[model samples]
Target: MLFGSDPGQAEFDEFVRSRAQALSRTAYLLTGDAHLAEDLLQQALLSAAKAWHRIEGHPEPYVRRILYTQNISWWRRRRFAETPLDAHEATTAAPETGDRDLRLSLEQALAQLTLKQRTILVLRYFEDLTEAQTADMLGLHVGTVKSTGRKALDRLRALAPHLEELIND
Candidate 1:
């Protein structure tokens, strides 16, 4: 119903509610700022709502495409003003365990990545999207997604060697 009075609105709303947490997590990873993530999520939801009538069989892909496009647009508009979280700010939240520290380190390392690289990583890891899915969502070639993912992983490894251990565990 929240998706509008279209035939697929109920199903779409169910899908949105089910995927909201995971999508928010991916958005947080993409933007690194909670506020921006919220904004991105809202924008994506609005766009998805508008298209719900036409996105019956594959709403997930439609919503993901909107989210990715909106994220890239947001990045382009804010590219100049964007800045990485400072070390102090990054560590401000007390980690519950070594694993959390590892996660924080990875987040910090993610902040160092170019926006595109960060986006690719978020789509790949946080969203659990395959390379082809990511490429489709981002309107890029599969090879580009693969290469970007490789480079992003390399940068993460270089920045936080501990992440490998954390990931493995």
Candidate 2:
């Protein structure tokens, strides 16, 4: 039989087909660059594919865990210097028109945060994961997640005051 004929492979394929878009978005949020996000998601999926048969009913959490930890690991190795959004980039955008401006501002604000803070915020807000869930995934204490999330939000507020309303929401 062909590799695709395997039940596990079929299930994995279906899961990817159904969830790739959402997963890709999550990856993009984790990594600011679209190309990096694609690579990150591909790596996570490959890891998942290897363990498909061992995975229980749903594989999203497992894959996401991989994505989250993998991102931290990659960040640690790259140790890229953080750059703040320039005044021109921040002020030139017209926020009144569309989501593009808000998105740019948020991305810039998020970029300013340390990796740990950014990861905490992304998991807490973007993923809608509970503190317990996030802590479990990151192997951090729930209190740590809560405190970091609060600090990240506070820092974001300071960096981009215009995002206050959306941030609170």
Candidate 3:
């Protein structure tokens, strides 16, 4: 029989299929590289699978913790390399176009941040978690989440001033 045919494994498979896109989005925001983000998500899923039996109810929180912590661990080992900006893309004009340019700009901006800072932003903003929830997920004090989130936003403003306007408007 296939592994997923077992009831427990079936549930795990369903969870992965349903949440994979969201997980990949968060991973991409964290790593700023599609390939690396995909790998990160795959690794997190494997890690979660190992503990699937012990995990009761929703496994998303457990998996997300693995994703954030594992990336933090990986970032400690290697330095981040920013993608070279094409000369044309360097000039940030008023975005008269769709979200693609803004997204690219945001992606570039996100890449400039330290791993922990980016992870905090992703958790608080992108993941739509409360400060307290984010703190619990990262094993940080609630104040740390608030402070780090503030610093991360400040850094983002410095990195991508264009995005600030979007926030205001």
Candidate 4:
């Protein structure tokens, strides 16, 4: 059946309408670029739509699992090169807000880390998932999650000591 004609499709559409922004932010954190994040989100949503009947109401976790794994897969394939943000470019692109510099610094620091490290930090701290939950989500061992999270935090601290609350928290 076509979309909008079925109740399941309507539910799915409503979910997307309500959750797209949050999901896009997660995707942007994973990909580090708005355009790439949109692509990643589109790919994940396509997969989710395919399995919509199976997942039904609880699609967030299922979709997030796809985002985490798909990001790792993309890194392994190396479809695009990872580049650190240039200081001038970063400053120029930063929005004119109270914490603009701090946010830009955090973004730059995150860009410096490897994809795995960035993903770990994003999942553990940004998403507020526990080590075990992050490990399960990423198909990693709990110890790996713990060690990686510590290392990622250390790296973040070294990169931007001014953001102590962000790193220590």
TM-score of 1: 0.74
lDDT of 1 by residue, 50-124 (tens): 776766686766766677888888878877887654444444343345766667777777877777889988788
Candidates' C-alpha lDDT: 0.75, 0.83, 0.79, 0.80
Total backbone clashes of model 3?
A: 0
lDDT tens readout by residue for model 3, 1-169 = 2345558788888899999998999899988889999999999999888788888888998898899988877876774553334434554555545688888878877776777778888887788889898888778899988887887788677667768865331
- Looking at model 3, residue 92 earns an lDDT score of 57
lDDT at 130 for candidate 1? 90
Q: Where is the poorest 10-residue window by lDDT in model 1? A: 86-95
Which residue runs of candidate 3 sit more than 4 Å off their true CA positions?
Answer: 1-5, 79-96, 165-169
> Residue 106's C-alpha lDDT in candidate 2?
88
Off by over 4 Å in 1: 1-13, 80-96, 166-169
Clashing pairs in 3: none
Q: Judging by TM-score, tell me the better candidate of 2 and 4.
A: 2
> Candidate 3: RMSD over Cα atoms?
3.7
Candidate 2: pairs in clash:
none
**Candidate 4 regions off by >4 Å?**
1-4, 79-97
lDDT string, candidate 2, 85-110, tens digits: 54445443435546887888888778
Residue 68, model 1, lDDT = 82
